[model samples]
Target: MAWFMGAVLLLALLTALLAPRLLRLQQERQERRADEHYRKQLQAATDHAITTAVRARLAEPVVDLHITIPMRVTVGDVIARALEDFALEVPWDHAAAMLRHRLEFRGHARWPDLITDVFDDEEDHTP
Candidate 1:
């Protein structure tokens, strides 16, 4: 009877000594899982924002043009140079004529005129 009681007391003491360590480990694991979940959510949101911005930028209208000019060298042969670029929206009507003049006077001739022609052509082609 005394031996049975002693074993029971020993088991209770061991359980008491180990319970706090087990509880602490479980709590740490839960916190780690929560942190991982939050990081994943933040990364997903950042990716979505970047994708949206890229799509918006791609949706903007862009035009590409290529120009070539040739020049004769004094010492040797002829040289040819090519220029290529893009143009965006430009308004070119009577109401916006002054704006167009200002832009052209600033040496943006090819760009402004090309953009204006594009808008005009689009309007004419629209049904």
Candidate 2:
């Protein structure tokens, strides 16, 4: 009886010790999967997507003002808009900052000028 009890206690102690590591492994796997998904999304993203994504993220959700926020524009739709706009390629975080800066200091009035200034293509006019 004593030996059996000792064996049972040892098993329980071992399981308790091992549980945290197992949980950590599970969490790591989830993070890896999430990262992979984000990578796939970034790959399929277009240049102007970064701009609209930033805009949507910055949008205010006002409740009492009779404002109902809508779902973010689809990635495919943003890519199509980018195709129409001829925007420059930018990394996600940088694009967000640039868009914010443009909206703040430059405003929508000079948007086209700002794009031309920031992403100048001298080659286009060289010929």
Candidate 3:
């Protein structure tokens, strides 16, 4: 009986000592997960905005001399280049703005001009 009581007391003491630390670790892990989720959501929104802009550009009739005449570049090449620029050079806010502008105006903006405008508008807006 004495040994059993001693063992129970030891187990309880160990649990009491470790419970708070375990709870703290769990809270930290949850916070990290939430932060990661937020970042992924932001990135998805940015990607969607940029892709929408590219789609709008492609859907428009090329009769308007807004797009640069590609001598050897295919449509796929242009789209790939636009995607790369959005990913590397254009900011998220600018991509979102471009998408909004394209949707609103339905105008074919030149690729170079679009990129220049994105860089020129330095407002910190959220998508």
Candidate 4:
């Protein structure tokens, strides 16, 4: 019948129109997953390198060192300030208090706990 033929033609037309879009969306999802995996891999590698360098420096002989601390502001904090009545500026000694708070509260939460792996020998250690 003509109606049955028209229904089949409409279904085929819809499939032809939607198939490429569906395929493109699937590809984009795959690409995003790949990007995230790559980012995590890169971060882990950077953390390892930094940890090794710090450990190597600490193992060296004592020397006077000067450190310039930076004020790191997060986007979450900025958003919170925009939403709430948070003070834009705190009282003096904020820097010192922040340092103390980080050392006391956050110092123990370091990941990959040991700087040097137990299985690593001095000769095979990364610097």
Candidate 5:
């Protein structure tokens, strides 16, 4: 009887030592999955925004126009980099028009200002 009780005590001690590590590993795995999901969502949003903008520009006749607009991405840095990359292939006028369309599609009249306002808030900002 005493031996049985001792074995039970040992098992309990081992379980207590191992449980936290197992829980932590599970938590880390969940977090990793969440991050991957978020990245996918961001990429999808970016692609959609760009496509919308291009379509909008194509809807109009090609003509020279000076328009300084923001990219569809919610982050200024990302928008700047995307604009730079896009400018390599697309003419400035077309690119600007597309960006404007994308911003409108995203329900923001001005993408840069809207994005800045969104991130500047101290509250829980999830878009």
Candidate 6:
């Protein structure tokens, strides 16, 4: 019985020593999967023009405007650039609402300020 308990104790010690490394490997695997999924989504969204992006102050979207996404650019950055370019003609509220519908944004979005500047502090408050 004492030997059995000793073996269990040894196993527990080994597990404690190796657990952090195992956890790190698992986390790295998850991150890789997430990155691959994000890349696929970006690839699929490419070659597609943002049709409804009205300028921040303009009544209509830019005429004959199209952006062919570069291979290296992230999707969020592309959207940010589009918003920045259109900031002068499009209304703030419209741009903000449009952003949510146009792409699947995750984590820290690149340029929230473009729309935030349009609304007052209370109006732009997001949880």
Worst 10-residue lDDT window, candidate 3 = 70-79
What are the Cα lDDT values of the candidates?
A: 0.40, 0.50, 0.52, 0.44, 0.51, 0.45
Best by lDDT: 3
- On residues 1-127, what C-alpha lDDT tens digit does candidate 5 reach at each position? 9999999999999999999999999999999997676445444444555555545545766455664343233333334444454432333333344444545666665444232322344233332
Q: Rank candidates by lDDT, best first.
A: 3, 5, 2, 6, 4, 1
Pick by lDDT: 5 or 6, better one: 5
Model 4: residues with Cα > 4 Å off, grouped in runs: 1-4, 61-127
Model 6 per-residue lDDT tens digits across residues 1-127 = 9999999999999999999999999999999997676444433332132322222224444555573222222334334544454332333344444444443342222433223222234264342
lDDT agreement of model 3 with the native = 0.52
Clashing pairs in 4: none
Residue range 46-125, candidate 3, lDDT tens digits? 44555555666667667857654322212223234445544434345544454445434544344433542333344544
For residues 1-127, could you state the per-residue lDDT of candidate 1 as single tens digits? 9999999999999999999999999999999997676444433333333334345545655554353221111100000000011111222232133323433454434432233231233344333
Measured over all alpha carbons after superposition, the RMSD of each candidate to the real structure, in angstroms, is 21.6, 15.5, 10.9, 15.8, 12.5, 12.7
Query: On residues 1-127, what C-alpha lDDT tens digit does candidate 4 reach at each position?
Result: 9999999999999999999999999999999997676444433333333444445555766555553222232222222332343223322233223323332343422433323232324344322
- TM-score-based ranking: 3, 1, 5, 4, 6, 2
Error of 6 at 41 (Å): 0.8
Q: Give TM-scores for every candidate, taking all chains together and pairing residue i with residue i.
A: 0.46, 0.38, 0.55, 0.43, 0.45, 0.39
Q: For candidate 3, what's the RMSD?
A: 10.9
- What residue pairs clash in candidate 3, if any at all? none
lDDT of 6 at 33: 100
Worst 10 residues of 5 by lDDT: 113-122
Per-residue lDDT, model 4, residue 12, is 100
Give lDDT: candidate 4, residue 90.
26
